[model samples]
Target: MVHAETVAGRRTGSPWLPFAVRRLLGLVAIFVALLVVSFLIVQLIPGDPAAGLAGADADLADIARVRHQLGLDQPLGQRFSDYVGGVLSGDLGTSFMYRQPVLTIIDNRLPFTATIALSAITIVLLVAIPLGMLIGVLTQGGRRRWLDTGFGFVTGLLDSVPGYVMATFLVVMFALGIGLLPLFPPAYTPRFGSASFVLPVAAIVIGPICTVSRVVRRETAVVLGNDYLRTARGWRLPAWKRYVKWALPNLLTSTLTVSGLVLTGLIGGAVVIESVFALPGLGSGIIKAILDRDYPVIQAMVIVIGMIAALINLLVDILLGLIDERTLGGSHVST
Candidate 1:
């Protein structure tokens, strides 16, 4: 009979089960860290949540009552304990500024943020992958020096530009300068169906497209150098088959890894874009909350955003493992 340790040591069987369990634990660790960091960071910031909630005219008794009501008057350890308990029990606390439950506010605006973030990432994958692979195929073996030079310069410039700045520039050019489009569409909430949705999504994707495509191109160039690819070339296989069949499968691991990381970052970018476009989403809400020193709203926002990011990375990690089972246990895959 095989020992359980020996069976485990072989590193064979369903890949995702163990991977999912491990990453789920990692998600817990990340959640705990986010809670601690968010709480501590807010504490470090100047000003008082109670004072903001009570208003300038509020007397000492009013501030004291508000503080006690919000549990701010409790000891630090007790406050943290209560905060953690509230989170585990699906209580995100109430927003002092909005005078509503934090989850309710997030629930209302979350769809907008989700739409923008998901749409931007989807575009990045669709555009960047094909564009990068095509460029990589074209520029292999140091061919097309001028095209390569131009590509590098262009993508680098675009990648360096932030999403908010990109949004502003596009607005200035299309709406304000050329008079082709309507001015910033922040008047109504922008959704997937609205024409107003175009600019913000465009802004978030532009830089990420540049970054991902460059990575893909570099990976493609490297993949072209492998022995199997050389053998394919030896057979004088057509360009399309050699790359589409031989190269794409290999490219999945790296592309997904990079795109997943970019996806998380796109959440934060969407926040900036939402504000620039004047959308009523988490971005605008969080900015207002910060200005008001609304700790509950800030913590809730951080938690929601952090969960989205963690989930994205977890999905990516699982995909990478599925694509290449060797990645199931990073730095510890038994041969």
Candidate 2:
């Protein structure tokens, strides 16, 4: 998967040092941008935040006091500076609605979101990699051509379905379109090993499994056609060595790249899934915070989610570098 042009750009200094420094610098830059954007975006929302939160009971002076309390009376630059200073000192401020520290609320809700995301991703990797390789091997050279067409059709259809739509459909079909659930329990809890998890997890995994599997399947087909693989066959190598040693490594590279993207999408996509299932995950929590104009909660969740997304992409690059340093390019790499 390493591009040819990158080879000429490689540094002669040290092997991984230059690459690691460059990546860490880029990560820090991304984090700064994430903080600025997350903190500022809520200020752009329409209406007076102080007045809205103060509600009908408060008079004009009460609203002004509320604005002062929130630093809304200050200049935009001054407010932003204070916000950054507070965050750097590890204070996310208090939630307007919850009347508690923002970090405390997030810590309380983190496990629910973590459970769904982790469960869904683990299932996707387990199912997609094997299914993809099997289909690739079976349909090679146009043998069993019908499997290719069917596989493409099915994966495309499954992947196109949104998480909310899938969640709703699953509930209706499997839950008998009623309040009662037959095959699975009604809701999710952190009480591990709950049968209630089955439906929500199934909803989350459908699209990701289809996406990662298709990438693997296509990569496998390409690797199978490689000259080195053909040469291995000519030498009468064992099937395990020919396929496992030669074919699977390339599959891992592509699979890891696509898996990272799918994970980022999962963080965003969990909102609708959480809504449908009435789960108290970060996704659903953000929706509530937005509606209530809870700035601390909103900003903190955005920072947390952005950090997760950035970290995932960074880890993927590191893995790609491990496979071959050339994949990470050099100092003057293209965007």
99 Cα displacement, candidate 1 (Å): 1.8
Q: What would the per-residue lDDT of candidate 1 be over residues 1-335, giving only the tens digit for each residue?
A: 45756756775456667777788899999999999987776787688888877888999999999999888899999989989899989999988777889999998888888888878878999999999999998999999989889999999999999777899999999877987666444356545756667777888999999999999999999999999999999999998998989898798898898889888899889789888887778887788778888898888888888888999998888788877887886434344
lDDT of 1: 0.85
Give one digit per residue, the lDDT tens place, for model 2 in 206-308: 9999999999999999999999999998999998787778898877887888898997788887777888887887988988888888888999998888887
Candidate 2 clashes: the total is 0
> Once model 2 is optimally superposed onto the true structure by TM-score, how far is the C-alpha of residue 103 displaced, in angstroms?
0.6
- Off-target runs (Cα >4 Å) in candidate 1 are 1-11, 182-190, 236-238, 330-335
Error of 2 at 335 (Å): 26
Prediction-by-prediction clash tally? 0, 0
